[model samples]
Target: MVSFLSCATQTHSLKPRAIITSALPYANGEIHLGHVASTYLPADVTTRFLKMNGVEAYYVCASDDFGTPILIQAEKEKKTPQEYVAHWNKRDYDDFTAFDICFDFFYRTSSPENIQFVRYVFEKLKQNGHIYETEIIQFYCKNDQKFLPDRYVVGVCPYCKAVDQYSDLCEKCGRVPEEIENPKCAICGQPPTKEKTTHYFFRLKNFGDQLTKWLEENEHLQKDVKKYVQNWISSGLIDWDITRDITWGVPIPGDESKVFYGWFDNHLAYISTVMKFLGDKGIDGREFWNSADIYHFIGKDIVYHHYLFLPAMRLGINQEYKLPDYIPTRGHLTLQSKKISKSRNWYIGLRDFLSHYPADYLRYYLVSINPYSQDDLNFDWDDFATRINSELIANVGNLVNRALGFTKKTFGTIPEPDDLDEKDKDAEMKIKTLLSEMTPLMEQNHLDRALKKVMEFSIYFNQYFQHKEPWKKGPGTNSCVYLSVNAVHAIALALSPFLPQSAQKIWVQLGMPGKTTDHPWSAISEIAIQPGHVLGEIAPIFVRVEDADIKARKEELGTK
Candidate 1:
């Protein structure tokens, strides 16, 4: 008797569990399309694909409720910081819901749970000798009778000599301020007095060599991201500032008068988000936090915080806590070759975009351009309209409408093919090949290429259907109908990750029993649509966008 055991056929570097976190946008403003395009949308797409592939994945982000921006915005609006954050939190949450961003826990960072974790992590940092005392000269305005936050002061950037830049970072050159030159208070138009304040500093130099080694070792980081991190290491990472003289944030452990810097406390929210999600079910978040396959999808502006400061803090807190497996830091999402600016009213709100178009349409178009892989992509409305109308509607949606609509209206059920041709076999093979090819690209975050490949197949499927002319009653008409319907099924399954809403609608129209997303992702090309399957209700999956609507949007955004 043979006693050989079966070995599994799958190879995996990824574990069973996944956690995705987009960078928390500050609570001072509404969710804009650029934010959604760069971080949230791609993260949502990745989470959808991971879930579809049966990985236990969760997407989380919190409104960055603590920080200079919130306080400054509160003062400008003549409201308390807490009141301001509450209003914007609800607004942003509602906007995300409208845009169909399926976050597991889109909570606020200013919570009791986050405060506890901040304290705990700080204690560990102190114990591990990473925390130290320091004194900093921060800006103070006597008229306001308070220390000015980052956004309340304006100066020419010391690094790039750019005038009228915020004191925290340079807008033109992307430099974090070491010391501002010729600073003045913008709030009261007063020259600020420098006030000395005691602050906590993290001794990052101790971990410099370790961070360098790890950054060099991480293969999953984007090429430019890795280079940027390495350059940071080459420039000599200094002790990081971990305290701010403000009352709106988590206070330092010993002194209630002092608060942790927003950057420090904000990163802790990533952990708090996971903990909150797990805590709802009476589970400790530490177990998963200690070893889960973690990914951070953040904008390029905050690369220093996540790559250097965060991992060092995590290491200081616990050696067992898993280091980041992937950090897909995305560049800016621009409009007409300029960065999106809400201050200038030069960006679209997620709500405004949703009112004009379907959420999935934006999702598809964004992934097609894929702002992450390049420096940036312009959010051209003409491109948006043309891609959706020509590629999505005319090709993919058209294939489903013609194939399934004709089958249901004419035959009432899927017809068994009298004979399969070489073209049918080739189409089936191409579907299977796409399934294999797309998995690697998705795994590597090559979502743009994967999306392009799917559209390529959709174009081929439409051409095949047009060549066959399945509507006319003639010899092999039933066979043509059969092949066309199955090809539609193949396209729907393959597109489930990229355009889930349209995929589900098409799944129903194909007479499938459940949601398209519920089917196994690996079964996309492997499973065949059986003959005689009755069609479900037919409905339009996508609608054509008129040139007038896009023109109106351009005019509203002040674009030429």
Candidate 2:
């Protein structure tokens, strides 16, 4: 039995600053809509929101370039692994750009800086007596000149009888992996030979008691996450295999032949990428890394890795090397309730989606279906048309365009406001109160709920404008227009985090120079548009997503 000690640490500071990271995508495949919706987009949203609130938040992610799957794909194309990764790296960057994922620096794991940091941590683990070498039998593929790791070998699952099950687990049925009955190399399509090799292993079992104490004390985790982590810790722990016989990865600190496991080095890229990003900005990176507030946005598939392996790696290197503060995870993104299968070619690529619709259209839809719980989300083109047309075009777009269009046409600009009436005051109070209530939800990582509140404000303002008939010239008509104009201004401020392009359009239409991000979140409650301000050219920001386009897309995807 392991002896337990208190692992409680200080909480995050009250300041608005944060260091955010998303799950790293592997370099072997095209990044799909599901990936952006779950990982990178959420982090980008958080970073944007934090900066809007005057927070010094930083976000960094890279392409995971190691492991057997990468090598297998490269071999099939008769290209070097490095060439394959570099080719797809450009594609990933382009895809993210098309969707407006403004990462600080979208680097790759093949960089010298990443190798440097991985080696540093490896050395620390070695000196701290947190790593041990062990001889174990692993499946060897002679043609590939490397031992096959998990996700590279296949066998029959005894419990679920699922063929082509991966090592250490059955993904389809979640069976605890057992010894292989029929072993085959996933790449070469041949029987793999078993060979005994010496490899370094991280002493993950050593940190279990400390992890349990720390996890219980850490208040930032989702309640379900904490419960699952605690149950996992209570069950048991295992020493993790942290190195392998591979040539295309970060080498062990002192040995040049052995490579660090993808599990070990992949997560370190989060730290290494941050170091490279901040260090280039002429800022000391450690000041942020040492802080207690660090958040990771990942899909639920990697929960074991992030909650178990990552924290242990940090504690192995140094106690003060802050463990993660909050880990917000989401379920899988499915296409019409089916898993996205690359082999089947049944998924929509980011490029394909952007061809038919604008980036914000997808952004709004994805956030609406964001998996706050463990339930999966299906990307249905029909539903996408409905929401964009109804909630966005019919509601948000109509309101902004009508209010700004009337202002530009009627007064040639905004007019001086009269004294406030009871209804006008009440409308102002509602928007202010809702915006105030949303701040906490965003801070707590409940972005889905906070977004719902923001949309509620949009509808409230729409009704208020309609009830007063602000376009008609009459007594108190100027005050009605003033309230409607200020309401649109407030909506733009609240939207900067979610739909930045639309928000900036609203800002420029209001004749505000620069971008919407220049305005802070606190500005949403204050009256921004003064009377007699010359409004700029007004146009609709969002177009209605048509049913015909969605039907064509569904046909393209081989759906109804």
Candidate 3:
């Protein structure tokens, strides 16, 4: 429930400018419904709304191209790590384009600029004494002469005696290896020995008090998000291990033997992407860089990493580099009421999903049922079909098609209504209020409700159509006719952000002059389509998706 006064007004304006970052997709796999619902969809909607509201905003994202996964993937594919990332980077770009996510910059961490910038940040952190080399006794097998991460080695759980417990934790007994009295390497059944190695660690614990103070003061953050952050702060932060035992990452600048840690490097992609876009804009990347208004959209799992480690990196570099002004995080997206597991092969691929349904429909569905700050949201196909078919096709689509169809068939052009009644005025004012109210929420990444607000505009328009009965009156004399035309103008403009292509279709079909993108922000409340306008040929904006089509696609993917 958004307050009425929270609606936009000339006096209470949104910030004139801002920068936003959606967590970079790790370049390991194709994006899934979970990725869309958790981060991309929200970020896309927010960026669109910002552009519509005439705000100077830029969205930045890149592929996380470096890390152990890249190396592991390269080995699996029998390709060089560089070759592997190069192939997937193009795939990711194609996926993003298909989804219509208008990121100003889509960069890759493998870029020379990114590596240089990442190393610079790492160097500064090291110089500031925020990072240090340390080591602990870790399991190693002499036969391989390699350090074994918990996943590589497995052994029987001492307590439950369940065989093949992962080296770090026993799934059956629910105890970590530290709790096990004796363990054998599951690989060779050889006794494990502790060997020490030094690595870089981020002083996350050092900034605990400052992070606590910052969270307490930022009240716009959702209650659930605040609670999550509070829990992390309450337990006290751990100095995050920022170095890894990998070779593919940005090599630690001076220490070629070590590489920039994944946690340390991945989050820096946000800033790195921005610099890549700035590309010597001469505005002093630092000037815009340290600005206080930074928004980060991410999933709940990575909250502390983004909120704490990200800001800490900035703080460790320049105390003045602004902390994230807003962090709008979402819970996970589940498939069939289960967590989307890449290992289990139970995730919804974006490309596969789009093959059956249009991107707007998928975008609309994800936004409609988004869990902005709570737990995971379920993406049941039945729920998906019902929402898009009912809300989108039935309600919003029906309103536009009916109004445009009636206007064209009856008059062959839009006819201005001579007289207006109370209902018409009320509906127009309500639309004004709705459009005004939604801008801020979209800017703040409250996209779930913001989209609902967008849908309600169509709801009201449909309600007005039914009440006014525009079909009953003669073209020139009907007051509802003009009112309906004006109503469609508002609807089209407001819907533009959510469904740009569909909105453009509505705009063109209405015979509005100029491009839909040229439509001003003011047109949402003030009608831009004039009376007595000759519209172009009517086009079907969205085709109904069929069960057979979806089923066939599901079968191809081996989804139940």
The numbered model that scores best in TM-score is 1
TM-score of 1: 0.94
lDDT of each: 0.80, 0.80, 0.72
- What count of clashes does model 1 give? 0
> Which residue pairs clash within candidate 1?
none
Model 3: ten consecutive residues of lowest lDDT: 1-10
* Candidate number with the higher lDDT (1 or 3): 1
Of 1 and 3, the candidate ranking higher by TM-score = 1
User: For residues 59-112, could you state the per-residue lDDT of candidate 1 as single tens digits?
Assistant: 888888998767777988999998999998889988987777878888788988
What is the C-alpha lDDT profile of model 3 across 79-172, one tens digit per residue? 9988898888888878977987777778888888888888888778888988887776667777656665545567677556777676445654
Candidates 1 and 2 compared: the better one by TM-score is 1
In model 3, which runs have C-alpha deviations exceeding 4 angstroms? 1-13, 141-145, 149-193, 280-282, 474-477, 553-560
What is the Cα-based lDDT of residue 469 in candidate 2? Answer: 85
Clashes of each: 0, 0, 1
How big is the positional error of residue 437 in model 2, measured in Å on the Cα after superposition?
Answer: 1.9
